[model samples]
Target: MPTDIAFYTNPMSRGQIARWMLEEVGQPYDMTILDYDGTMKAADYLAINPMGKVPAIVHKGKVVTEAAAICAYLADAFPDAGLAPPVDQRADYYRWLFFAAGPVEAAVSNKSLGLTVPEGRERSMGYGSYDQTVTTLEKAVSGGQWICGDQFTAADVYVGSQVDWGLTFGTIDSRPAFEAYAARLRERPAYKRQKELDGALIAQMQKSS
Candidate 1:
């Protein structure tokens, strides 16, 4: 049986990324949009996720938190989507996924905040430096049209979201490779549909405000 999913979110947050993943998987979900007055921190939601974060999902009576985790879970649950690779490809899948979540996120966050690694600790930094991370990502995307290869997998959803958000906020440089990669991702029907839905929701929210 397919599990019923409850997606707790705030559209303005990273929850948008999870929304995109859900659309990619073509899963039906019930959404509860949280407001800024600490509503997400309420006792009930906190029971679902103590961290009071958006992008949490309750499926089959089990709660899954964190954006990346939710994306990965949905891919597994909906095998028909083929967002994930086979067991033999699991190693590469986990590698690139975590690489996007950890180092890529850290670099983007730090860059947005104007933070820099200490001069002596540069070598010890997980992401090395923003420029180095961007260069590494450029090479990865430059190797093929997508992150993993010619195929578009869930890895692209995760990593592509990072690259898309980074470019949108100017946190990451817009090299030609990155630009081309983002263009290809945007051309996907799933991505376009999700963006349109999100845009309408945003407009409605603004009108109500």
Candidate 2:
């Protein structure tokens, strides 16, 4: 039997990340778009995700929350899509993937809020500092290639999404490395196809509103 994949999402939110991961995995998923005004907070949705957040997934009777976790799960479940590395590269894969969700996210959120830690507390902070995170990411992409060296894995999908979103919203500086990395991700046919479909839907919603 094929996996029953159900995606709970709000198109305007982090749900977009899960949508992109679905596209990358090339899986047929049922989408339930939730509204913030008590729709997602409803008992049914809350049962699937106690946190009442979108971008949760139910596959084969198992529920998965968090955008990064969903992305990683889909990649592993759909190995035919080749979005994940083999067991040999699993360590690096998990490292960068969580790094994206953890440190990268922390740095970006802090920077956006104009929150800074004391100089001595840098080591205590997971991301060290916003500048350090950006510099490290720049070096990671400096070779004009994907994060996992030559191969583009699920790590790219997660981290690349952050890089692309950050650059698009002007939340992150547009360094040469970031620009090139984002360009490489944008060139993916899967990414383009998903973006085009979502863009049209967003436009229609805007027109209706």
Candidate 3:
């Protein structure tokens, strides 16, 4: 039987984020592993995502791309998963989710590539300064529960991934708040399962190459 969801990804990419969300949703899905220099950029895939990126999904014929968007979409699509805050209670959910997608992602990528914002030109960048972005992120997750209080919404899946990856790669500061938040996220069964699935795929790809 085919699932309504068709996930296209590479285990080594941001696809891991979507995979975690899928695991949390507990839905059956079919996965297609695309190679970076091959089918990922092929015409069929480019038709699905012109950006030629991994981490794209087709749910009931509708295509969704970008890791953050995928998490949010899955949460909404699978309401039974309880991965999204109620409409009236989504202020923090939307805020922090997009915060990680926008400011945190931009800050980390720019810093990794050694692209510093010129002094006083921080206003031009969406994230302002990298230090400011990191500080703001620290405050958001320091609350000790989830991104949206007691509920473990999709916002955590997206925002937490940024913190988790940042901590592992040293792209973000290793503050107690960030560390604590990631520790809690690690405790999720879905998170652990996502890692195991992707880790095995990565190992296989490496062995074959």
Root-mean-square deviation of each candidate, in angstroms?
A: 1.9, 1.9, 0.6
Give the top-scoring candidate (TM-score). Answer: 3
Error of 3 at 70 (Å): 0.6
For residues 9-77, what per-residue lDDT tens digits would candidate 1 score against the true structure? Answer: 887888888888988988788888987667888998889988887889888798888888988988898
Candidate 1 global CA lDDT score: 0.85
Q: What is the lDDT of residue 128 in candidate 2?
A: 96
The TM-scores, one per candidate, come to 0.94, 0.93, 0.99
Per residue, candidate 3 scores C-alpha lDDT tens digits across 1-209 of 99999999999999999999999999999999999999999999999999999899999999999999999999999999999988999999999999999999999999999999999999999999999999999989977599888999999999999999999999999998999999999999999999999999999999999
TM-score, prediction 1: 0.94
Residues forming the 10-long window of minimal summed lDDT in candidate 2: 138-147
Candidate 1 vs candidate 2, TM-score winner: 1
Candidate 3 off by > 4 Å = none
Ten-residue stretch with the least lDDT total in model 1: 1-10
